[model samples]
Target: MTTTVARVDVVAVASPKRRRRAPGWLAVVPLLAFVAVAFGIPALAMLDGAFTVRDQATGATSYSAENLSASLRGAYLTALLGSVKLSAVSAALGALVGLPLAQAVVTSRFRALREAVLTASGVLANFGGVPLAFAFVATLGNAGVLTRHLGLTDKGWDLYSFWGLVIVYLYFLIPLMVLTITPALDGLRTQWREAAQNNGATTVQYWLHVALPVLAPSLLGGLVLLFGSAFAAYATAAAMVGSSIPLVTLQIADALSGNVLVGQENVALALSLDMVLVAGLVMAVYLPLQRRSARWLA
Candidate 1:
């Protein structure tokens, strides 16, 4: 009888525990709903529009790969390639420059100086769009004050061209990379350096093997982030270059605005699909690198 009562009590305790655990999944429901609304629905719409077409005269709807296929050729291809090239260059340069800036900030003795630089970086990283474009144009454009004073226009500096766009992108990308990599730099334990020194490993040797390996994942992830940022940018490029530069984002705008050509809505959708794929690819690499870096830093 005593054993039976003990078992009954155990069963009663387990029931409450199960009931408490049942509602735990409810916390994740809102985030899942948000993802479905924000990303899933738009993705499905893009996929549907990218492959399906409507007849202009007959009003018939049919499914075909023509829109997507078309996005891979001619001007579309040029825009896609140009966007990729720009992203690669900007991302690469941002990582290279930001790494040193971040290191300098991390190693600085002055707390106010470090905080000021970080604060400025946070603001500048988000400071893009037409305002940013116009600011750069005013300072760097062919007839601007700086351009006139510096004689950059005389030296053939064209703000509406590819290289000028690169410089503009770098302004934000470098700061963003600094913000992304600074945490990883801080997570570098002092013990590691002390241990390296105890073993007669010079600072260069210690960083070459110890620091770089640990930082590699974070650096790559930051580069991917910069790439995606530059890839999807539209307003800045639109305000600055218009159709002079054949970026994919600019192509999509032109296609959707109906100012360039007719029947380009499908092309716009196709290009959006391409962007989604590229973003998905970027996330795939970034998430793994982030996880790996977290393991080391945490």
Candidate 2:
């Protein structure tokens, strides 16, 4: 028995085959191709033009920074500053108005009410450009129904002025803020509030100490987004006020279409580059704040 037991042995071996995985890169190819065709090509072309200049006499093309330099001078600078100011004002107004609306929606007891508010916000956020401008003009323009009935024009309320443009911008900007900030409001944990209450903190104190601190990043992110939206806007302002507003976007349109100057196509590209840089800077600040907000939210 001992001899037979000593001669017997068994071993198990693992399989060499591994599980097959679908190629992840393959899934992204379509998106990459679309971006390349739609965004990359245009951006490259603009960049090339931005750094290029054409000789007026010989029609020769050469690389130079004159276009970039030109963009920072005279009316172009004024337009850029005007766009920034408009975006800043609109974003501030939107945040101020939309925050309370978002809070009200989030704290509502009725599910239908919340849904309706969110739905309305979604619609209004995208309800921009020509249609929005037309609506505002119809409602607030000279010979408008309200203006005719209320005699606002008699009080010197011009619908095509800077303040009027701000009012029109607020229509969409507030809704966008509501949409963006609603999630951050919803993410305010019940436990945190309860813990604050348990520590003898009032509602106002809790909001000041705990809720606002957590929400700061999200709020800043939303403001930056709103700024970007207002900065890039063209159709609404164009339709409502034509070239009277003197925004960077309007300037770009003018340059591109030769409405202002015939040989400033390269300047238009440079302006586009400037817009892109500003948007990129906004996102650069936004991304970090967004990440921090996500961490707490998660």
Q: Across residues 79-118, which tens digit of lDDT does each residue of candidate 2 receive?
A: 9999999999999999999999999999999999999999
lDDT per residue, candidate 1, 1-298, as tens digits? 9999999999999999998987888888999999999989988998999998777788787898888888999999999999999999999999999999999999999999999999999999999999999999899997788999999877888998888999999999999999999999999999999999999999999999999999999999999999999998989999999989999998998888874454556888998888889999999999999999999999
Q: Relative to the unseen true structure, what is the Cα RMSD of model 2?
A: 4.9
lDDT of each: 0.93, 0.92
Give per-model TM-scores.
Answer: 0.92, 0.92
Query: What's the CA error at residue 75 for candidate 1, in Å?
Result: 0.3
Local error of candidate 1 at residue 195 (angstroms): 3.2
lDDT of 2 at 21: 30
Best by TM-score: 1
Error of 1 at 43 (Å): 1.4
Q: Which stretches of candidate 2 lie over 4 Å from their true place?
A: 1-19
